[model samples]
Target: MASKIFHPIFFILLIFIPLAPIGHAKRSSPSDKNSSPFNFIKKLKGCQKGNSTKDIHELKAYLEKFGYFSYENNAHAMDDDFDDTLESAIKTYQKNYNIKPSGIVDDETISKTTTPRCGVPDIANSINYMQPRDNNHESSSSNIHTVSHYSFFPRSPKWPSSKTYLTYRFISNVPTYARAPVARAFQKWYSVTQFSFEQVPTNQNSDLVIGFYRRDHRDGFPFDGPGGVLAHSFAPTNGRFHYDAEERWSVGSVPGSYDLETLALHEIGHLLGLEHSRVNEAIMFPTFSAGQVKNLHPDDIQGIRALYNQ
Candidate 1:
């Protein structure tokens, strides 16, 4: 499992200057929001000028993360010079990110690469967007049930009764804080279900395994660059939840932050055989924003109940 190489230029910029100012200050700048497709290729070409031998591992890692690799017998190749291979990779990355696949890096692509992977913009103090709307009745359209109805329901399997356990393993190392929210997330899932799920001892065989790594984990899905995608998972067959450790994960109630616990809950849902929900209010929705909590909203309950009725 290698990470995808979507926006290599943006990532390199971040590393060289962590606090460097954005070139454009106004929100309306054309380049501020769009990024050209050839940005990474151009950068790679520039870097190659100074150093003849370049490490394609970084680019290879990026491609693997976003579910794009050689399909023919699982064999893949990386081009030393930004050639046809690079062009194809760019198009694939653009398609996944919802950008135009013109094969020319533009400003909009850059914006998407830099913005936080998930979460809505905070407009509390700004006079631009209006305040949040309120409805007397629970938002029916926002209801999770609206989306759960269409998920692929998995047959209930016999799970451990007393000692059902989940484990989180990092390929190299993970921050202590990172593991904490994931544990809390697992607990949140356990609270709503009849099955009692708990964290097993560090070295014990586990019912579910949660893995965190940069690139090339056991399963196929690899990680993309830092901001493009947060993480992905394998369904019930493996019960593996892998998060990109490179991401700046948030774990608490914040006005404009990505809650780690919330993400874990969503990924865990996938592990349990739940698919992305069409309902915006559902936690299982494919895209999430800041201020969205990870708890099982009523709709999630309805969907889970559909799977296991007690």
Candidate 2:
């Protein structure tokens, strides 16, 4: 039930302003173009190329960092050719970065590959615009769950059955540090609801697949440079959770670190049919300030209870 006032409108407005002009601008001719800045990084040449015939563990490792492959080794057959794997990896990279999904190595793909992952710029400015002016709620803990006007419509469907348990899966291709916080995120919901949940390794039969990536992966919600929206999730039928690969997700009990657990908890709340909460105290608030999601408030509990009650 975190405050739902933090709508995507704020972020959309910022992106639209800068991008509108670029979309309408005339394209530069190839002949008029000078030396390309991305000409040098046209291939995966910096790292030692693994044996093309052997299983390319190193190549997989490299691609996984950018959310290309699922971390679960068994999800993909080991016998698959490294070249083919690399092709898929390249394609996902292209999709996230807004390039065409050709699955072929090209100059544009190389250029984007080398660029660092970060959220959208002007995030601070956008947050300021959307948030209240001269608000002094930081010191007051009692108002955390107070409902406000910005909440969206609750989208919960009828419960399948009281006996029908809900399941969630977090499938990550990033490193261990990135995937570790997911457990605590699930726990956030279990803390308030009567439902039982567990994290399953990515497999062919898994009900939900949570994949993380930076820019483009498979779905159309291409991640902007690190700071824009932290991540996005598909609706119920397509339960896919994708993270912006550019984020250095924090996973511990620290003050300033970005809590991966907290973020995932919020997103999963979305997955569970909850929309953004009008109450700032709820964990489902659309935007998060640093170190703000240590716990869930009563509004979140109320929403979940309403959904699960048959």
Candidate 3:
């Protein structure tokens, strides 16, 4: 197989950037009828680069929390002015979610802003994983030939080759009902990858740990109640996965409740070093809706295989 190369422009990402609080979501579907974490954004819609509103500061903070705003921009994040920096960040965010890069708070941008998403930033450490990558190689095994939307954390971290089989355990405080759905999520991943998973006793240290917590759990990355962030996990070798206990989570399709298995698959992808995919159908897509059940897309398969050289 020919060695595949990603374009240099696609690989650059900042490191050690601080994370701010991302926006929240509506309690229900995309119908635009419920409480939103970013309801303030709706009022600021149509505002652009020279416009200023007291709510603009909230918008600035929203962008900063999700890895769109830069450190230098913090000086202006507290102010109500919509400056050039805020416009730039909005453009980047718009481009990320496939909204037009108008740099204005348009209806489409507002809709995305209010959607429930993972706590992990779409552009973690300054790497906008939502950007598409050119995949020109013909896999000798699968013979896939096409562009890909899958991406990785900064430096593409992963589990060591020697540790093909991993043991995972739920924290003692995790809800009893969440275990089965989460376990099923692990089974789905094992079917696609060159790895196997085993559930171990909580008393034993395992390769991965899963838990649920409410606001400010002290993990550096805090949960933002019922709607905003569903869950988040670290890149490989960290193995800490957390779900927001405040969410209305269920094992199957239920109105106003997030499907546990679907989100578990997503966070597990992060645990395995896969970043958010721009392809909306892919489970790795940054935002997920309530009562939604998503399966692994081909882009997800291609990405993981490419990452581990499978």
Using TM-score as the measure, which candidate wins?
3
Ranking of predictions according to TM-score: 3, 1, 2
List runs of model 2 lying over 4 Å from the truth. Answer: 1-155, 253-257
lDDT of each: 0.47, 0.47, 0.78
Model 3 clash pairs are: 24-37
- TM-score of candidate 3 versus the correct structure, residues matched by position: 0.85
For residue 79, model 2's alpha carbon misses the true position, in angstroms, by 53
| lDDT of each residue in 233-257, candidate 2, tens digit only | 6444456666665444455443333
- Score candidate 2 by lDDT: 0.47
Candidate 3 local accuracy as lDDT? 0.78
Give each model's clash number. 30, 20, 1
Ten residues in a row with the worst lDDT in model 3? 5-14
